[model samples]
Target: MQTTTLTSTWPQTLCDPSGRRQAKPRNKGCTMVIDKGIGQHAFADMLSTSGEYIDIVKFGFGTSTLYPLPVIQSKIALAIKHGITVIPGGTLLEAAVRLDLIPGFFRQVLELGFTGIEVSDGTINLSRTLRNDLIRDAKSMGLTVYTEYGKKLFGSRIDVTDFARTAEQDWACGAELVTVEARESGKGVGLFDEHGECREGDLSHILRVVPNLDRLMWEAPLKEQQVSLIKSLGPDVHLGNIPVNDIITLETMRRGLRSDTFELQQVPYSEYMI
Candidate 1:
């Protein structure tokens, strides 16, 4: 019965810019990590070390199907014990749905102790109605439903209106959060350009239209992208697709402990600057 705590002190130069929100075990501003088949010991270590910063852990792509069932079960249990939700990637679900094994997939996932589910069409084409139905079904099964937006491809452009519309619809259909997919590479997809840089105009447009930015998770796998997003969206903007090794680093950036975002809280007329 181990639990992780957010004990890191806030940097004096960076104030909490997210306003009011739940600390941990929270519903908003959640960080969902994409796991790429790390071993049980490594997973446990991650939980023991940086679990406080992680809200959800997704078995990236179809990696869950590749692992031994026992390993998956143990990982799920460990994550839940740390108060973090665990789930298989949406591509696996899409495969299950395509092969008509979705029912079996959900049953096995629950039996294995997963606390959440991601409904995404990154590698498959899912109609809006079907996606909505899947979200409803996942919610009915008592799984925290995290739906995703955007395709997994090079040069995938995000339509601000479409993204905003999908976000609203998914929330209405019981999705806990809507992920903006940048894939594992975090480049040439969603709002990210080919070099893993975020397109500011697209981000600004989405922010203007999307009612609650907290419900949107940007999949930023690169440090530069993470720094930029955190600086622009504040510490609590939901981010995903983070590499396993960078969990602590991302937390440091969020808290302004890292030099990249250490200047988020300068006074309007600072004594030093004046």
Candidate 2:
């Protein structure tokens, strides 16, 4: 399926406060929304309102399997129509791996109109070889592949060395983005501390090792986390696991429309005259 390119509604002549955010089909500044459950109407409304700002919509965890086959197909089809890559959560792949039903899972996902795949082992143990193979296999199927790093357990911190190595290898195996896992809660996992605050040192370390920061997608579900990461990593950083309702607000922040990031925007000469 061909992905459509969407242009921003804001006038091109005006300067954006947070500098210029990239348009749709962008490699950087990508946003992946985590959809737990929303009816077809709400889904369509979301896309119609701010589809240009979204890059992907992930059916969180195993929720995709809970929906009716037709509903799943419709959602995936709609997302693809709007140029958003839709995929079941990586947990589903983990389940398939555990059950030895990888092939069936792949068949079912493609048949359901999913255009992307997320390969993650947050809860399950996955070997490096298996991870590489899964990434390659998905890419060979003409699906966009996103691989995630880090475990889901609370207090599970990121190991800079292992993350660097794994991210490098996943990219080598043809995955498009290496996601940093923060779970849906965005607390006590990966780069976040128990209070949902960022471990700034660890975040810096990761950036230092991964020079191509565009290849990383940080899972920032909370507003604070999102704001902090955007400030720390710049507005162009790719972020995932955003709530469905926050698409417009997040986009605003990226453009420096929100108070938290308003200072990032530049002032016009007329404003200085006042």
Highest TM-score against the true fold, candidate: 2
At residue 170, give the lDDT of candidate 2.
92
lDDT of 1 by residue, 1-274 (tens): 9998988986644444323334698765567788998999999999999898889899998899888988888888889889998889999998988898988999988888888899998888888998889999989989999988998879989988988899999999999889898999988999999999999999888888998787888899999999988889888788888898998888777765667876654345668786
lDDT of each: 0.85, 0.91
Clashes of each: 0, 1
Model 1 regions lying over 4 Å from their true place: 1-22, 265-274
Lowest lDDT block of 10, candidate 1: 12-21
Give the Cα-based TM-score of candidate 1 against the true structure.
0.89
TM-score for each prediction? Answer: 0.89, 0.93
What are the per-residue Cα lDDT tens digits for candidate 2 across 125-152? 9999999999999999999999999999
Candidate 2: pairs in clash: 17-265
Q: Considering summed lDDT, which 10 consecutive residues are worst modelled in model 2?
A: 10-19
